[model samples]
Target: MAVEEVFYKLYNNILIETNLQNTNYDAVVLIAYPEDLNVQLPRHIGSFLEKAAKVDKHITKAVTVWNCDYVSGGRLVISPTGKVTPYHDVSVVKQAAQKGVLRALEAGAKSPLVVVQSVVHFPDAQLVAVLGVLEALYTPLQMRERVAPKNFTKIGFHAEETLDEKFERIVRNAIALERARIITRDIGGSDPERMAPGKIVEYINNSFSGENNITVKVVDDENVIAEQYPLLAAVNRAATRVDRHKARVVEIEYKPSDLSRVIETLILVGKGVTYDTGGADIKIQGKMAGMARDKCGAAAVAGFLKACSILKPPHLKVIGVLCLCRNSVGSDSYVADELLVSSSGKTVRVTNTDAEGRLAMADALFKMSETAGKELNPHIYTIATLTGHARACYGNYVAAMDNHSARATNHSNKLQLSGSRVSEGVEVSVVRHEDLAINEGKCKGDDLVQYDTGAKARNHQLAAGFLIKVGGLEEKNLKYTHLDIAGAAGEAPSEPSAVPVLSLCHLHKVFM
Candidate 1:
């Protein structure tokens, strides 16, 4: 099952309400780290501790210390009386409470789901804190349950203090991230063979069935050859032989009601290869295990729309293009020496079929840039799980990025700062014209060529160069940034990282 299909069904109704009603709560979770154990609790909660100490002597004495360090995680206490949790770090106390509350309900609580959902109250120190807290609440319900009970759709923030706009913005972003996470999580767990090009389309279209202020358009496989989107079509040729799925270019446009002020459009392109079998140049057995998650870039965009369907920017329209295809093995697969035409009218000679992400992206980028060039001021950004070169260079903490557009150059610093603030890190690099020049030379007779299977580790830069050509960005002098999330695409092999979604959040704060 697609995580997007199940979890967000319930998550969509979640409300981030201020505690104006002052409803009496069944549980007021008081979470404290060991560091805060001896310190006096906040006055409001301290009142509960004093009363509890007189009634229950166990908490009155020193609480037992565990072996975990102060830098570790935190837990939730169900009682109004403050209690020591098993983990560390006071910041994560909010997360603890959400998780604890969900577990309690799953084990069969008698309270109506809505009452149980509304009654639990916790503290929110900042907006980013809401992200962690939502994780605790939303993730518990993401379990692949068949007949999960209907839950209370709203969450009441019962802080004694009121929240400002910044706090509310955080709450919105947290909600968005929760929506995006489900798609990636489900994709990470889905069988690679089943997540083919056709299946990817099914997942995407299903996730975005009916939404407001948005229109989803696609160039399906039926028109792949007719439209001259040859590169993307070639990538899915192998898969088409075995399945009905075809290479597709999905475009989602967000036009806010007040488009009177929108002059520039922000275009995001995501690489989607549901499963990378490497075609004729297949990967080794062990390396292909996590290959099913190749479509995560597309998942992020779908997730973003799921989260921000109603959050149309006042001054700008946002468009996302998902280059969806599955690089598989069959008689029809494009092999080395075959030349394919891109939507930009450029011909690409296949050198490595496994490097198919760029092929799918090239035509989609060309289509987006072409539209943006004529209609709106284009600010183009490409996000993909493209290369091992990036992962090898940056490890897993930061997603490696290449900025070529002048407008996007200014946001590089913001990307890193915001990444840290949101716990999604970034590392920016310079994709020089010279790098593009050299990679193009590999094309020889053709305009460009995918790198050979064992080619030197220039892939990080090389791949970006190829995408630039297909996008026709440099030709039009359009601004662009390429984010390669290969290294940090997932927490583990079977898990997907909500990587650049945080980067998008950072961008939303700035550009919107």
Candidate 2:
């Protein structure tokens, strides 16, 4: 598809309508608690709900459609968020908004006015609700090509109490986030062949062609990749022979216009395993069904860079690397028990070919670590759907493990808090001495082992340790965090969740 044709799909047709009585919209999607339906909602919506409550008892509890004349087309879609609790967070609001938008779409409403009744506990409820609505409205890349191109004509937002500037900021931030998420979802959720390494490079080149302050550099040559990123090249051994599925190193950078405004530098390396057949240690028993999503970590890196390109937040310089490769099973596939030298010069003994995501990213991460020392207050991150042990441990929540420097600064906890506010769950995992020890090579021939086949505990945490060791971050005094998104990258048969993009943006104050 042409760049212009696909560009519009990344953003929503967002419209902000402050006037509650505006009759231009086709439907009113109300998201609120049962008790606040009458109190917090507008007088017209509250009155309609009050009248409907007398006739229907389940009106306040379940998602329902009410016939009313106060709004446009006489269609009112009420999506109730269950009782808010101290334990509950903004995700409830996000989920309710998504459901409300789905219901509005089903009702044949091309334009819907969405309103959220904010809770005191969740300060970012309105923003979360808007994000959720965008999530529901997002059409997959393949669907946009073959089926419906867009979900709605326009999405309207109304806040009960807000100044014009604050409302505009909320809308702008949400749009930027959703736009970034669209890139992530497209690359993360597309079929393996559709989003092959070469195709991803093409899509990225088209997506960020003229975006200001953003630069993209791709390394596509096989010999150069083999020379510079041997570990990654090893994982790409079989696929390198095929032009379409060969490896790609996509480096994206965002720089502030005023160099004096920069206070810190952030480097992100993401594992873009377009398709993981587990190489020589091939996956069996239906385990390879959703392997296309293994690249979500890299997808998120691109999305985060997209957000940076849009917002152009000051005082920060961000660099993102998408370590793209395909771990294909063939005659030339890299097998286990092979010792390969990493970019950091550490010898890695391949213990399990299934553990390829780390190898795909290790060289880029090591290179980033080398550059982190010169940048201003730099922090490096390695994000990947690298382990099943993470899913076994956290179950659909991102697990963040910090190195010594990041742990000293309480980085993971900060991410956890920021993520919770934006409806993304982040769990903090500690990388201990044992975790590091698990990756220690069994024999004297290798410096580190690729996978800990013998030990059973902390496999996910150990993966982080392996990256730190192989990426040359160990004892480097550079702040680094490894995000294992195996469980949270997006469950099977669903669109990519674009995990941690909002969290990182929020933490860095990237939005305008």
Candidate 3:
């Protein structure tokens, strides 16, 4: 049931296929310079093959390389229709790669694996290539009502272009696996039973083996309520009525032997709402269709840690918490004006059950913050698909973040640049002390309001402020930030996580 093969890396005796007919390749891919396709007709008809490749450009169709024939070998040529730019950015390569796959399929090539034979390439060429392959794999076939084309999953990359070092291959494969899982889980459909919070815990558990050196923790429903996570318990009681799956908070930890960065511990928090019925405050029918993706923030965190297990940066111990649950309907469901106490000892007055994502994380945030500086140096960051206002503001190009610490503020800027370098973009904004005050005073009895009374324009900022209060991170101790991925998740292929995975790697390697 695991999704593989679509991201395969060919190695050793299969390094580079000089011939397609003698090998088992259904289709091949090659990047060629504009002039290479404009060569004069060879006495052996090399002249005609180059002409056919060029004329297709004038028509703006896919670049048809005559590599499919046994005499020429099955190489699908990749050249920009109007421009011949190198595959430097991940987003650019992703789009081009998806187009290449479609064209190869049109040309009767199934299970196409893009092959790069260039002697010179980008440093992260393999990374860019896999991003494209994932774009194809992650695109659900019209509501996922259909399976892989004819139930045949064939598209992948043969990374002969990568370094021969084993570590490099491991890192590349790690990213591939993590991203594939992230995208699949993020855009997965609204099957309450299939994608329930309980199911996600198992899906994430399977991602790491004993070799990864990561320990996963799942806080059960009984324990959550017992431990005074009334807010999280309330959301769970409402969504999971009679399912028996129950609600759980999942935690992941990785401590590496090699130490280099100044950052000792990085804590990641994510929202894992399996489905959003909006609870008593239900979403309209059209809006409800894609609510299954509500857990994207949590998925990204899980994916980021999976990559961390592979990289195992020096001096870095990573802990990730997935706030798992749903916002559904029932007589037990929480409604407006309900009083709930957070694990931090703060009270929350529920004004909108739809705003349950942040409420779900309240206790976990407090627990993680308390655990942060207990061992190694501490840095806390929260990633969640919490608000739609952010998406309304930025679409999918930028991740809107509320960073803490002058160091974290600088790191957020650096993360944006890192994301840009890899084609994953991010944006940062500050949550003022005044805004935190507003949330803390929004209601009479409770210490916090699930929904702020201020303008809707500030929901994203208020949500950050709420999480900050829950984690006792208001003092901005260590390093803290809230990444509201609502604006950055979905709406495009392989987007929502554009910033999380690469940003984590960059923070650990370049900025820390």
lDDT of 3 by residue, 162-281 (tens): 344643453355345444444345424335566677777766666565635689988775664547567788887765555544677788887776545435678888887888889898
Q: What lDDT tens digits, residue by residue, belong to model 2 across residues 349-448?
A: 9999999999999999999998898899999998899999999999999999999999999999999999999999999999998888788889998889
Tell me the tens digit of each residue's lDDT in model 1 across 1-512: 43454443222444333342333222223333333435334344455445555766554332211111111111113322134454322224434444444543453322211111211122223343445445544442225445563553344443334445554454555555666666655544466545555666666666666766778887775565437567878888887656545677788877777878877677888888888888888889578777877887876776665545645556667888887778888887789889877777777788888888888787778877877776667677788888888888888655444445543556666676666555566786667775576557364568776654444656687678777766777666777778888887874433576677756755665223
Q: Give TM per candidate.
A: 0.76, 0.96, 0.82
Candidates' RMSD to native: 6.9, 2.0, 4.9
Q: Return the lDDT, model 1, position 498.
A: 61
Any idea what lDDT model 1 has?
A: 0.60
Candidate 3: misplaced stretches above 4 Å?
1-23, 31-50, 59-89, 111-126, 138-190, 257-263, 406-409, 491-499, 510-512
lDDT of each: 0.60, 0.88, 0.63
When 1 and 3 are scored with TM-score, the better candidate is 3
Clashes of each: 1, 0, 11
Worst lDDT run of 10 residues, candidate 3, spans: 36-45
Please rank every candidate by TM-score, starting with the best: 2, 3, 1
Worst 10 residues of 1 by lDDT: 111-120
Judge candidate 3 against the unseen true structure and give its global Cα lDDT, from 0 to 1.
0.63
The regions of model 2 sitting more than 4 angstroms off are: 1-12, 34-39, 147-150, 161-163
